[model samples]
Target: MKERVLDLVFLIGVLFKGLDGLLELVGGAVLLFVTPGQVQRAAERVTARELAEDPHDLVANLVVHGAAHLHGRSVWFVAAYLLLHGLVKLAIVVALLVGTRRIYPWAMAALGAFLAFQLYELIVRPSVAVAVLTVLDAVIIWLTWREWRRGRELRTTWRQTVAWVFRRPQPREA
Candidate 1:
């Protein structure tokens, strides 16, 4: 059914979000533990072969350039951001998968705040990766909203069914 398909897509999105969060956690740890100079050196070492293969490789050059500019303050900021964001996202994912009514609004609110921040970032400083993330978050928000609405409808139906089942017989009619 269409509803099942939508639910499946939502589940997939949540899993993807969790995976991204896990990657962010690992990246944060790496950034936290490694010195800027060491990271720059590692980037150079890792990209040397690729650069050699393709002298004008965009990705290799970007990595080299980005690593070269990594500063201590920026590294700390990014590490903290990643670790916190990852932890929050993983927690939200767990809440979403558990099928609870009360948690959805909180999760949606958290995601909405993230989306707002992302949009502001996009306006101030745009990047392909950030744009992709923004889009994904938007889609997830819409899907989550749909799920919340569906849950409300299901709850209403369940309550009505229970009420009807428990309704008293009319003595006057009898």
Candidate 2:
């Protein structure tokens, strides 16, 4: 029974990693074909806006509208975006494969689920993805605490070494 459960968990992790890879491909294509012109046009619009007293409004307006205008540029932006996007996806695939080899099974499972939750709206059901993110966030936080503790221990050791080296030696004579 335990073996079967472990197998199931491992299978789920592999499946989620595959799913994330697929989504990254699709997202990269979309971003490449759509982002440059939109980004350029948005930049132009921000420049066109009447000068405002508060910089916040200008910043907010650009953030809210720039991405909505993805059709503003030619194919060059698409080409560059897709190229960079592909490189990023390749790096992620390498990480996933490396992680599977080096990390514990449960940690691998958590990593896969975390990626799925983060990309939920893109790959899985949006509502379900949001729920997964909420639940997985607690797990991620706990994992982060372990990492933080390890870092603290290292820092303490480093501090001790520095203190020993830097402290003035006691005076031998009055």
- Residue-wise lDDT of candidate 2 within 1-174, one digit each (tens)? 553343334334434545654665665566665556566665556655542545556454555454454554534454455455445444544553454333333443554554564575445544443466455544443433343343433233334545654679998996
What is the alpha-carbon lDDT of model 1 when measured against the actual structure? 0.81
Provide the RMSD of all predictions against the true structure, rounded to 1 decimal.
10.1, 18.0
Cα lDDT of model 1 by residue, 87-164, tens digit: 888888876655476777887898899899899989998866678889999999898888787775324434454555
User: Residue 155 lDDT in model 2?
Assistant: 32
- Report the error of model 1 at residue 31, Å: 1.5
Give the best candidate by lDDT.
1
| Stretch of 10 with least lDDT, candidate 2 | 149-158
What's model 2's overall lDDT?
Answer: 0.48
What's each prediction's TM-score? 0.76, 0.31
Give the alpha-carbon lDDT of every model: 0.81, 0.48
In model 2, which regions exceed 4 Å deviation?
Answer: 35-100, 103-128, 134-174
